[model samples]
Target: MTRISRILDADSYKASHFLQYPPGTEFVSSYIESRGGAFAQSLFFGLQIYLKDVLTQPITRADIDEAEEMLLAHGEPFNRAGWDHVLNAHGGHMPVRIEAVREGSVLPTGNALVQIVNTDPRVPWIVSYLETALLRAVWYPTTVATRSWHLKKIIDAAWSETSDAPQERLVFALHDFGARGASSSESASIGGLAHLVNFRGTDTLAALATARRVYHEPMAGFSIPAAEHSTITSWGREREADAYANMLRNFGGPGKVVAVVSDSYDVYRATAEIWGESLASQVRAMGGTLVVRPDSGDPRTTPVEIVGILAEKFGVRTNSKGFRVLPDCVRVIQGDGVDEDSIAAILDNLRAKGFAADNIAFGMGGALLQKLDRDTLKFAMKTNAIRVDGEWIDVFKQPIDDPGKASKKGRLALVLRDGAPRTIRAEERHEGEENLLGEVFVDGRLTRDERLEDIRRRSWR
Candidate 1:
């Protein structure tokens, strides 16, 4: 029922080991005995709790035991000894001061929205390894969330059509095809789901599941009937059509099927002949609707003609309810090569021909995620200031004139004012500071235990 269920089940967790180390790990024992080792242990425990909640899967005792076993198993004599020495140097818990922007806030590039520092002067280097992965995990999600927010703004503006329909207008679904080979698979999943918080149009099911598990977004987009089956079957109908039918039957028809790709064979012909009649009838008869997709073809002519056919030959009627009904009536969705400019052009032509804005939906993929210029959504991380001596130091970029790359050194605080989130450098924070990163874990216990759905909802808001 939940999205996380699609990717990982209880059985999978049961079979997997949490940590892997070498056997006869006197190293672990020795390390655990040391002060630095204790701090590392605390950090590790804290990390596990955060990750467990983030992952939304049970972190069992068996899983932890398995992880220890694996770590010991993989530890060489030297590694074990080294690990023990490293642990002993920092036996007590090291205070970690973390300041981060609220999860949903928009952040600019080259900004230190999050600053993690070891509060204990003795074990500064202890938490270094954790930083890379931790930052890596958080960065992509934030970027995706920001991008999705902008995208929602654009969609809202584009679909500013006057209608006397129901309160609900367009529910967006994002499909992250760029995940196939572009970004890290996990990053793609997280990013796609982040987008769903603001823009509900995403087809990254795995990410959706992750999002649902960590952030409760109930509905997600799927391209099984549109792209998946055909891509798997080499354009053959046996598997493709069967898969489509199965999905329709299982998911309960076209209302569930957001956009169906009929362009695999012939764009117009498929709309009129291939899936045009049967699919439309099946959806309509089931009290559902399908969005006919044109994945390839002249965007200008194909969509307009398809809409015309659906409105004219198919006897589709735009009733007061804003529902277009025809024996072959289905919303037209353009996927491949669709951009803002192209979408604007398509919408203009459709309007000129008396087509209702709600008569079509857009399944955006590569254009929104990958095709945009690299600099369109600028994102980066920079160290604002580092404490060298006892006194807090103010650090700034050498070339202060180039404000874009400048960094405000020291501890930083972020605040939302008048609807916009702003960052105040530590030196500039004359007022009280509001720390963004709270104590997620303390002494190997979860201090903040939130449902994944709750986090998702929060992220969206």
Candidate 2:
């Protein structure tokens, strides 16, 4: 991968922002908020990753020269004097202080998640100058984490109502299938790690390494041996049974779990006959589980029907919740056409059919990673306060056309009021109140390093 200079990782217009700010501007304070969108709350994540990956790399003279040449060629003004001042004065480290809620903290959308301000009096523009990259770094994974967290909530509700072992099964209900669908390897790694905040099952292999390297977790997620369409279909149509048997022989064992895609020829026949009859005894004797995957069908109804078919073929038992569940040896997974609505609808359909939620799990791909955008959560970073000529001034945007586009004002502090987080003026914080936003980064250094374990624990709503 080419290592583009982080200095150039901004909007072309950002190159000229240093000169646009008012003269004598000494400090600029900004905050990031979701401002209400798809969800009422969001799972805060990925800031530490950005601080460690991007901000920690000191800007070199070479980076400055490269950026200057590129920006000039692109017809944008380059702040060579500011770049040289940062390089010579502060050794190329961004002169900024960043305070954020602890990674993995779940908070309401309208509250502040991160606060940024220029530490040096000379470069107030640096606060907003970092917005383009900084906001991108925070929003993507945070939105992904929020999506995963809410999915957990949906599953948790269904499992609580219909499963005997909701707590045990909840961890593996939603598996990450977004690696190939992700825009890039880096995206797969981060988005995959975000899903791990709420679940333990994932197929995104890069997320494991990301967890180990970024959050100091040796292993953040797990996956069983699973078969895709290519591996199962390569046996030819007549030998479909051979493909299923091969998965059982190679991956199935005592107390092991193996998933096989059974929708290549006909999902109904494959589940009701091949897996339910020819290999029924083998599956029962394997002392493990066979996860039957149906890849192409109605997202809301197909899984429910397959679960009913499996229960008849393999037999069913009524759990303590009074919901029918398949034998431990056989289950179903729906990997296609899955999203928040489809997942909930499927669970609702399963409950309506008297099947336990544990009869099936979900494998979410593009919808989990690539389909969302910054506006999914309505995330935005706006300057809330600035210091001019050593006097503090509150700043905000109030558009008459869209009141929802309004931004917060004044230096802010996120504090707990009656056990709930409230964004309030920093000066209005009462004595003895603890601000949730702690200084996480300062002068190009990470002040607080968060671990994945703690982050996952904090994410549990």
What's each prediction's clash count?
A: 38, 0
Query: What are the per-residue Cα lDDT tens digits for candidate 2 across 126-181?
Result: 88889998999999999999999999999999998999874866889999999999
Model 1 RMSD, rounded to 1 decimal: 10.9
Residue 456 in model 1: shift from native, Å? Answer: 5.3
lDDT of each: 0.47, 0.93
Mark the regions of model 2 whose C-alpha exceeds 4 Å error after superposition: none
Q: What C-alpha lDDT, on a 0 to 100 scale, does residue 423 get in candidate 1?
A: 57
Q: Over the stretch 382-416, how does candidate 1's per-residue lDDT look in tens digits? A: 44444444444454455657555444555566554
